[model samples]
Target: MSVVLAGGGSAGHVTPLLALADCLRRRDPATRITVLGTAEGLEARLVPARGYELVQLPKVPMPRRPGPDLLRIGGRLREAVRAAGAALDAAEADVVVGFGGYVCPPAYLAARRRGTPIVIHEANPLPGLANRLGARLTPYVATTFPHTPLPHAVQTGVPLRHEISDLARADDAERLARRLLAREHFGLDLDRTTVLVTGGSLGAQRLNDTFGEAAPDLRAAGAQVLHVSGTGKQVEVRQSAGGAGDDVPPYVVVPYVDAMEQAYAAADLVVCRAGANTVCELATVGLPAAYVPLPVGNGEQRLNAEPVVAAGGGLLVDDADCTAGWVREVLVPLLQDAAALRAMGEAAARFVVPDADERLADLVEAAVEGRRVPS
Candidate 1:
């Protein structure tokens, strides 16, 4: 059967859909999967790389302020619907599964008109505007959080990569993976601890700046560092703090790290944004993290980090208060105490709900195949 896996514009939305698609393909190798995204969405880069066909649509991220932007969004949505219709017709997709983003609203609507089943997956604890709009078009809605308020929304934890699901136990796997990946990928000293820091695919200026400032101190403490620098900041970070270690580059900074499995495997601790996907992935990998939520829009990112923080697996750092000094002070002690880090990892692991991808894949398949999902 054909599945139009619709999601994009952000890594959070696209990541889960990819996980679900991967699970569905494993369940049935004959499953024809196509991704719906715009030229600008991360899917344009990620989907095709994964060997899935991408149906490029014209989509604009919903504007925070409504005015000409809203009008432009409306026009784009109409165009998006038309583009999705063409994609659906060309691919002969039987069902379209939307992993909640701006692209979802139009794609879900097109699927509805075609009498195709539409399944919406909302990854955030709180619903976004696209999911809210898409919810009106379909009765099959799934959520990551248990208490989401959307009607017809069932609690199905966010789907993560198979690599994460297959992670071994705390000491056996994390340590083993960490040692191998750190030495191989970053060429850092395996004798000392390693900290992996990322700001997502788009990267974060604040994170890079803070970490870059602490490069000398981080290296002096015998901690190998792998940092992800935002697009424009890569040159700056490399030119400034990358030359600390004569033999191994003390700190390795890159625009992005595609191999998340390796990164998670290599890290003793993670320091980054508290995006919904990051939260789920951290739990899946069972890593200790110092979370700094992006200070855009509302405090949704901080809210998402709540479950992890409360569980004692992660520390919440408000972006406004996250400074190089604060990060150094908090992480230096945690890194030194291996027992505390292990305890935090165990606590984070408690939040990971296994078989999330399989559950979501099963639900989507059943809905499209006209089989009732398990009650």
Candidate 2:
């Protein structure tokens, strides 16, 4: 069967799209996959890198306010829908799968116009405008979070990469071995408790500054820090008056980590933003986390972390409250308490659906075959 997948603009959208495409190919080697995205979006590079045909679409963002830009959107959207429909025809798509992003609205419209089956997977708890609109056009809608308000939304969880998903099944000995290797790879001390601080791929300035300031205190509390400071963003470690001693734990910083599974393995606890993918991956891997939701963007990040925190899997703090003092008071003691960390990690693992990739692929197959998807 041939399929066209639409999503892009950011890693959040592109990552899951690629994951689903990979799952579909693995399930049926004969399947042909085409991706629809803007030429400027991450998908331009990532989709091709994954060896899928990417059909570039003009990005026609739906303007929020009434303005001249809003007036132009209708014409732009018409052109985009025409291009999208042409691409769909060229690919002979039996089904079109959409993850929420700027490219989705046109794709969904084109698929509907052609009477091709459409499946949508929304990765955020708070549905975006594109997916929200797409959900009305199709009965097959899957969601990463359980409570996303979409019609016929199935709680299939997020489609994660195999490398991240496989961590859920690691035996104790294997886990330890992987952890040791990961620590060695990162140049972190194996004996010390490790706290990983990340702000996703682009990095967060607030995270870098706050965590960088607290690094000395964290080391003094007998914990090593592995900080992924984002690409081109440098984190300056602030030492105390006496400066760091040989006995103090190591503080390592890197611009980016291409191999994130290794970083996840090496970390005893993680502190990062509450993006849907990050939350799901951490839960799938049974890693305890302190999630600081991004202060912007319609409050979806906080909503994403709520279920995990409510389920005893993780801790949540607002962006403004995630100060160095808060870290010293909360994170330091939590790191020192190994038993608490174990309990939280177990809770996290229990909350995840590790086989979400397969589940989502099943939905796509059901759509293609015109079979009823079992709820």
Top-TM-score structure, candidate number: 2
lDDT of 1 at 102: 70
Write down the RMSD of candidate 2 (Cα, Å). 1.8
**Candidate 2 structure quality by residue, lDDT tens digits, 185-287:** 9999988899999998889889999998998789788899999999899898998667777777889999888668899999999999999989998999999
Q: What is the TM-score of each candidate against the true structure?
A: 0.91, 0.95
Question: In candidate 2, which residue ranges exceed 4 Å CA deviation?
Answer: 64-71, 240-246
Candidate 2 vs. true structure, TM-score: 0.95
lDDT of 1 by residue, 87-113 (tens): 898889888898877778778778888
